[model samples]
Target: MSEVSGPVRVAPREAWLLVATFLVAVAGLIYELIAATVSSYLLGDSVRQFSFVLGVFLSSMGAGAWVSRYVEEALPGFVWAQIGLGLIGGFLAPVLFFSYAWLGAVALPLFAMLVAVGVLSGMEIPLIARALKEIGAPEFRFENVLTADYIGALAASIAFPIVVIPFLGLMSASLAFGCLNLLVAGLSLWLFRARMRAVHWLAWALALLVSLAALWQSERLVSVVDASLFEDDVILSEATPYQQITITRFRDRVRLFLDHSIQFDTQDEYRYHESLVHPVLSLAPRAEKVLILGGGDGMALREVLKHDRVRAVTLVDLDPRVTELFATNPELVPLNRGAFADPRATVVNRDAWRFAEESTDSFDVILIDLPDPKNITLSKLYSREFYGVLTERLSADGLMVTQAGSPLFARQAFWSVARTMAATRNPIRPGAGLWTLPYHVYVPSFGDWGFVIAAPQQHRPRAPGLPRSLRYLTPDTWAAAQVFGSDIGPVEAEVNSIRDHALVGYYNEGWDTWFR
Candidate 1:
């Protein structure tokens, strides 16, 4: 292998082919990302869905590479692959969304689309390389084609998270990329018109037209699919970079769903938010400062602000889109009673785990109002390590509470959270362990939901006094919430930590058994 590398001259035709390769690579990776994301959103386990999607897609690409050797005409094969990629990849998100909504099952259809896109993507590079060689270009190396592919993939990886998901959303972004693929096909047809047949021309025109049409109507299509999934008329639907936020209304009742999991129902949400906030706040010796994590909707903030002693409240939630919507939207602002606009409330849009680990200020009460540990990312928030960090931020006599999942439905999960919090020793005094008290409240929207209140020492079980305007959580009801029935009582379970995500498994298994 002598070093014969000078400036390797590429003709205009070969350069165009390389551009097509880059565009195909971008479209291919976008489809793969869309599949993994959609699966994770629908399936409930992000780590598993991403692992399966990556493995299947790479292997299918290898299979496609093997099959590409049989094609006699390289240009025709490349053009057809582009057409197929545009048609399938462009509509992949919409099809998956509609299928999950209508069929109530997406595993079969999701994997099918994944394999089709991967195979077509895999075939593209080989066909492009062969076409480059077939055109008698001067010294065009195979590595050049791969360089364009690798760079294109890098571009897509950066854009998908920063621009695509937040601005265009999954449905529109996929359709837009599909149109890009179709344009690449049309460009290929024009570049090699001498070799293209009449059928290739017709196919290129049809695919481009279809992709453009879909791109134009992508929002309407998503609205239709979303209407099928939700029970009521969807008034607000947004896809943030972090999660999907949906709000629906029927008559006087409104519901908020994050990634299709119900967060609160306006009819009975007072019960949930009241139970989550008031118990620990009522028990704290001097609740001057409060820190709230994951209650972006400000419902918990509303409860916290009800107490006049609260000087300031710092609320940490990851998604600004969520907090902003609830803060400003006229329909939603009333639900939280304009908590975000309060003078004492400070909202920080950042990850709870990172904020907990990095926070320097000590709080009199720390409230963990996060979602269930359905995935590893959320599971970490419920882990032993995260609890340790949170414990460090609590004042000497401070109290902390977390909104644990359903005690009746996910018994192990609820107790596991209690156990994890109990295991968290006070950083100031290693000998003084947290006192854990688990309780449950029944709401009309969600039955048998649980909460865990922990502090340095045992606090009074009965509330000193409650807000007079409270719709739920009277002093008597608060006392009864600590008493659990035998059926939903605690069981032995391992502590959840960053290294071992025991909570996610317990959560998934417990919910799956009940739902199944």
Candidate 2:
């Protein structure tokens, strides 16, 4: 559709401006989400990144809206705004990734992009409304433009999670949306070329060409950035529905990271796996039915199989790719000792919390081997509600153990987990406080990691004799593991509930201190 400034006016279809609004809305939100996701991935704190990004975007939009009154021309300005957003928003992911990789920071560039996109986006809607008004649709201009904007935002929210993230990934998705914005600019320019300036046509062409090239080379760009981000050679990298999975190899050592948090380093994983499994298993010597939650790597399963008494082991992890990789990949098979292939092992790829709600089966021992409470998704697993679900399935005579994060680094968070379990114990019954004990072991890769073992009632925990040999956790080491220094000892903390997820706040606070 075409609209001219001054007394002269050319009438084009109203649908063009409405469609532009829709496309611009989708493109704007996509950039906002991309910035939030990339920052969370790199920075390890979702709540803070998203909060900051949203604040900057909204403020910039206001600034753009206020500044739009100064421009004499409307159509040209609108076209150039779209092109500018496309160029900056489209290249944002790769630029941010590489910036963090090379310069070790993403804050300045990330916020700058957020501001630019927001301002350009803010300017577009008002210009579109004015253009429609100038073309003799002034009466219902606000209603029409507002409706289109809302519809476009709704479409973007729906498409982002379902289509964009799942198929194209964060980086590619950003580039693709950038192309969409540029296409809108080109389409608008082609339709209204008579009303537009030569600069608008040139801007549209340049933005389209740049976005197309970036989309074509998105994979290579991702690879180059990842190579710099990770010290080791990135053997495999992909964006799964749940998380960003990357496996890196440095000589003989292999490392797996989910969402940039290191899961395990093959060289010293035995120490961690051994420590996680043996403490509770030794106490509950007759554990036959085993349930492994979130230990997708199969290292914990290998440890569970070491006991002759374990008749059946159920492994519940959120990601199928993680389980499948451990089960099939030749590089990882040796590390887990082909645990998933064993007759006793059952691999179920689903949310651990949901599986807990549905499963009727009881377990002699439950190992809660999930990631730390770095984000809300993970924080839910560590909530009081989840522990209550575990309480139901846990055999009265059985014991449960969880891999809590580092006591030294995240002291309050480490103890908050203990507090959550304690708070959850007696919620059902007045006198039913859980028999809980906190212990920790130091692995070379992660220093001063903690674990919490809980039982139905108080019983003397005896470190049982193992059927096979262990690389760590002897009787003396086991005794020393329970000893905590004053600094890393218990703190007065709130329970981590599903609604509040107080653990995430505690975790973010405790961890952020170290960086400062």
Candidate 3:
């Protein structure tokens, strides 16, 4: 008598249940991904955040399935489960962001919400399957429902990164998905109204109303809470495909942060940039062409342009929005000295490694001003393989300099750069027997920051002679930078590679001492 049998047709109402299953499945995974992404944004270590979030979520789901066995009447329980999931998952992003801003803590409330949603989500599938089986859908009911659930999850996973985060951002995207969950609940109630008794239609209606209201005002609410996360006024905040970029201002100073890590503080950025640019550029005085790997803020480019010999500069940065912001923003223009506006500078917004691999032209000086290798994505740039690629683009007398992070804080990580450069595979190119000159500068913003200058066959760089006007580095100061205290001296570190992320681990372990 059921649809899967000889001559029976599926009931329209029973068919809708499968559709509801798909929607619920989609909402469940979206909530999980949202939690993981938010955690990554706040916490520097993506590996730790995602591992913890997934482990906790799956455990809670198993508990939910175990508890579902006691529910004798599945319909009402299923309806309430959907409602609970909708309410919690819908508001998760806003709640997490606010908690991070106000309490400066997210582990407790984040896990609480994840557990609550996972339990409700876990209960949903079993209850739906049971209801379908009881409706006389035949033996194929289990297979049919499971297939729909998987398809829904696949759709959500693909759409989350491509459409949701890029356009609506985290807060609006979560609320929108929350509405989808509520709609599924409302649809289920309408379809099964005949079997219901004392269904709280009024309460359900009020919940839907509140969800819609919150969705309408999600942006404004998020903006208010987002402002609290930073000390200065947040002039611009955006979640791009690659990372979250925020620019803040306090009086005349502006600061740039990528994924919650400060790139540069405008107040003392000169000390950092001056040291990063001048040492390499001065050593290679005839350097006409410059390649900058990661200074999207244009601060390093500003210093690189100060030299009269620089003819053309190619800056390869992964994020276009960072370059766009620095190029156009009035507050940041003077800070970067309108470097992007110069005809000599060409901005290629793409991955540095990819650019290095594909670029045919060689440069006299290459400045690697990338972020610290705290995560795998950044660690790849600091690998021996990456240094090998850089060797291909260096001219006969060219020099490459990299910002090697804080020598005092991340000593092993600092030395790992020199280790990787020395391990470059192409050891026979002109000046191919690469040697790294390690040095450090005391920048008040980031104490005891280190840098490494790598050149072919050069034991020690011929002092390029400091620029006549520099805020931080002088000839005497540059020489003094080579001396390191016994406490912050180098430790044995492995050469980082695409296959092995030894430096990432070292960076995490080294920085943990300070952050923890």
Per-residue C-alpha lDDT of model 1 across residues 216-239, encoded as one tens digit per residue: 988899889989999999999989
* Top candidate when judged by TM-score against the true structure: 1
Q: How accurate is candidate 3 locally (lDDT)?
A: 0.86
The CA lDDT of each predicted structure is 0.90, 0.86, 0.86
Off by over 4 Å in 3: 1-10, 138-140, 197-199, 429-433, 465-469
How many collisions between residues are there in candidate 3? 1
Over the stretch 1-516, how does candidate 3's per-residue lDDT look in tens digits? 666747657787678888888999899999999999999888777877888899999899888988888878677678888778778999999999999999999888899999999998889878888887766665445788889989999998998878888898889888888888889878778888875555546657777888899999997887787688888988888888778888888998888888878889988999999989998888884689999999999999988888888999999998888899889988778888899999999999988999999999999999999988888878989988888889889887788989999888888998888888877765456444477888888988888999998877574465666667788888888888888999888788888888988998888888899878
List of clashing residue pairs for candidate 2: none
lDDT of 1: 0.90
The lowest-lDDT stretch of 10 consecutive residues in candidate 1 is 425-434
Clashing pairs in 1: none
Q: Give candidate 3's TM-score.
A: 0.92
TM-scores, in order shown?
A: 0.97, 0.92, 0.92
In Å, residue 299's CA in model 3 sits off its true spot by 1.2
Error of 1 at 506 (Å): 0.8
lDDT of 2 at 81: 85
Cα error, residue 215 of model 1, in Å, equals 1.7
